[model samples]
Target: MDGFPEKILLATDGPVSMGTATRAAVDLAERGGAELHVVHVWHTVPSPHARGFIRSGLKEIGQDKLEQQVREIVETGGTVAGAHLREGQAVEAIVDQGERIGADLVIAGSRGMGRLGRLALGSVSTGLAHRSHCPVLIVPEGEKAWPPDRVLVGHGSFEDTEQAGFLGARLARTLGVEVELVGVTSESGDAQEKLHDLDRELESRADEIGKVVGTRPRVRALVGNVPETILGLYAGDEKRALLSFGSKVLGGAGRMMVGEPLDEVLNSSRGPILISPELHPASKSRVPEREQDEGPQRPAVLLATDGSEVSLRAAGYAARLADGLDAKLFALYVVDEYLTFRSGVHYGDFIKSLSENGREATGKVRALAEEAGVECEELIVLGRPDRAILTVAEEIEADPIVLGSEGTSRIEHVLIGSVSEEVLRNANRTVLVVGGHPEYARPKGESSGVG
Candidate 1:
């Protein structure tokens, strides 16, 4: 019943950014009596005649070096650490290895390389995240060195909030840390009334959290936008925190979209985010079931990002979910293939940059997870956004997809945007979308759309 991974797969490309990931994998293996499977994927670029020979030779050399590095990391621990080197797409190879070995967790590192590197070399982390069956832990370079201190739990009006609360409290107890219960209330009322109501809700929730965790937490009731508010709180505070929340399914117009609050919180928060699916009322009874299932439940999460502030918030929330569920976190950075066609940038370069940015963003998410003492995996993709997200979720068997919400038009009161609308219409898994900046308070009757 220890809150630590028992068997993990450390998937790497032998990149310098993976150093932190390696350290984390070794640490977890040693601490949790876990077995470490070090997987290095050598993606040999296809080429013509003579160049193909040269490329193959170079790939072999790189593989050898990477194997040596894996050996070094394994030497640092007494646990079972084996190495697997395969040639294919990074994501595919990693996923195949993980499934073959029966790994419980998949660990990876994010590469912050610029747009060009991402284009030339697709983000393996992102791809593996989308395809891996086990929980994926993505550790950013510097963050892998720090230990988690505070845990942030995101709450909304969804049915999953209660379960999220339970999971957050359990994690805090496991890490021996304090939990911060944060709830975002839009300013749709008069200033005075909004403030009063916000205070009451914050206090009440804080009290409930205190009882759940056996300790009172410092409650924060901020009046502003939801994403901005959450980000601002973390920006102002220097404490290392892990954020947690739940993913809910939104079905409308024959489509399914993840809820918004969770999406926005995930994208904007700099700390790690833990996301869980909405638990049914029966599961909420807290009574022991007929039997306890020991196998890890598939922790499904939707990672929506566009390299924008709002999208980043979504990624942050997904990182927290990876920690909470001990599930694999998939980051879906859509290129808006339609938008890209209109953007006029060279498709190759643009796609590459987008992929690279996705990696950088994924790196940030991994950093947050490491700080929270959690493991993760990531993915990068190219296609129309809504379709791409849905396809990836199904392909990876993701149960919940986290997304960011923004108004399609300038109209206020539009809680969800076009992409979200499309996702809600089509997505099969639960979706959590986060909207409203947390910094600015909207006047009563004012529009809530991004103006």
Candidate 2:
């Protein structure tokens, strides 16, 4: 079962994004000798006459069309692809289907919806990517639709850099690609000497790992914002690229204290990002305690959502990280009591609606995992936002929980509801807080904060 995840699930909505996602999925499946399952989610408007009748009919029709598309693609020497269609919210239906089929991976495209549209409709891709209990691959718009051939890894701490080098070399060997080891240091006042020393140390470490892997890796050291510098390296004349990084420097304690740098890189980078958790000496000791005995399990991630645009954007970051770590992906949607209480709606109805929405999001994520040929799981829960999310994670024994920043500034984060902040402070596991609005268009000649 070492290389057995050859089943790929592709989630589509019969839109431009779906087309893009399908292309990417086919390429990956072909590369990995995987079977492809293409799924389409159709939305049906309910009428007064009968419940779900219209939806059922629409789903059959949509399924047929999607099946035709899959047949056409497969017939033309593409991947071995099959198609299925389901009724209901796009994200949920896809997730349920993936689970039913025991898909190895789910793939989906990031729909280029504008800010307002994304806010109202939410992002199926983002929601599904976060929640699916498998590796989810997201194909961004205007990017190449295939597994990366050349990889770049950003090294942070000494231990982390060593891990990054080892992981990079292994990945390079697996993918048969060259690995570029990059060490970034900020140009903060009077730190030039310190930065240089760090750079030399990182280079030496990378070289050692490269020798072990029988690959000659390139090493680079730069002084600038870590995020921006890393991005710049990849963007500069590197058409085929995949960004890799260590999950954290100091493990659980470091992630909690200093926050998640990988989250920021995932948000700001236009390309796919891979994250690997550092292995610690403590993990080598045998301990009876559940926490100590278990050690870290590649940093499994729980992605939380409210069916909001900001939360959906957080899914992108989570998906990239999940793929990098080969970690299990779980998508969660929490139904806050405030919304039901404020709307004066029946609690049952509210729960139903919320659950449906969560399922839809899960579908999108499932598609992403399928595309990437990674396994995933989806979940929906009810209760307080923070509590429900945390509870589900604990129940699942998830390692890291990834969340959106709620688009709040520092002052607003201090005053307004800070779910991410609270989770970061309280959760026993690691937390990744993504702070950026996907809908915010980047201006021409502006850098996408990669370094």
Candidate 3:
């Protein structure tokens, strides 16, 4: 299986925000011949004693509304496997109900665009993204009104190479639309590994998608921030593109652990973000103790080194993360010809000196990863700083790229154009633009997993 889902569940609330999800789910189910299940989780289940009393006295006004919604869906010309009503915490109920029917994809609505700085994602949609056993699809607000014309995949390293990226490509094949397996990157050094890896992976996925869709799809990766890069690609076609991504199932059981790249995109952006757990439920990310010894479960982390004060700090933190996740560490340093004052003319001696410095920087990071007992690969490449970093990360399929931040790099509004900032803006996978110290910063608005 190329990981395209077989059974899909649409979790709806009787609200305008659900418009996109409802349409997408029906379209996907109808087109793919996949079983479709629709679930409406209204509220928590009352106590047994209270239930009887409330049932007799309460009006249950929404029942009429729910039925009307169902009729419209049926009228749209698709058969529903089941349309269920349940009570309890919205996330829990949806997961539980979906599991009962063995759902492969869970679709839900995110709050629609309203006033500037106003993101009002329903609590249920947010919770489901963080906790569902299967994958999730967060429909952007106002999409119910427009059908998509293309599939925009936020492609990157880690589990997504095989999971979400491939699936998104496949979906694009199925839809017979252009597929953008886009990558956003930042770093300085050899991007060959990442680029090669991306090429091989996308080629393989295109072939697989070709089997089902009857035509091989095209794939490409551009260097930039994941969300912004994706949005830029969809700048004129926003209403016609469905943006897709992978989920973080391997870390933070009850908490949402979106990578920094996705964190930026999901917060204030308005779009459908198709998200699947990076690993299957049976995978080792957080598997049971008995499953621990069965396979290699560690994710890889990439470290971008410029030998700067901040880059060194990032290396130290990368080592810590490698040890924590038992992950492989890839240290990359780009001999930045662009950073040189005379590089515009390609001065040979200066370029040689820069290359030598790049090797030293990567060596420093390698030593750290080794000392921490983490698997490590060190490479020095000559290129633009940002592209080098992203390319290497992609080649190795690193789960996260770790870098020391000035705080404002990724989230800090002031240090907007720094290396750290560029990586976060354009990374395809999770990015860790770590600060020397820890702090909590939230985006300007409150929205669901998909803004």
lDDT of 2 by residue, 186-230 (tens): 677767796778778767877687677677578777777776666
Q: lDDT by residue for model 1 over 360-435, one digit each (tens)?
A: 7666666665676665555554555677677767655676788877532343124337778888888777888877
Model 1 ranges off by over 4 Å: 1-3, 16-18, 51-59, 78-80, 99-104, 112-135, 143-145, 157-174, 190-221, 245-451
- The candidate that achieves the highest lDDT relative to the unseen native structure: 3
Per-residue C-alpha lDDT of model 3 across residues 86-116, encoded as one tens digit per residue: 7665677888998899898888877533532
Among these predictions, the greatest TM-score belongs to 3
lDDT of each: 0.58, 0.61, 0.63
Could you estimate the TM-score for every candidate?
0.51, 0.53, 0.57
Poorest 10 consecutive residues of model 2 by lDDT? 249-258
For each of the candidates, the C-alpha root-mean-square deviation to the true structure, in angstroms, is 15.4, 16.1, 15.6
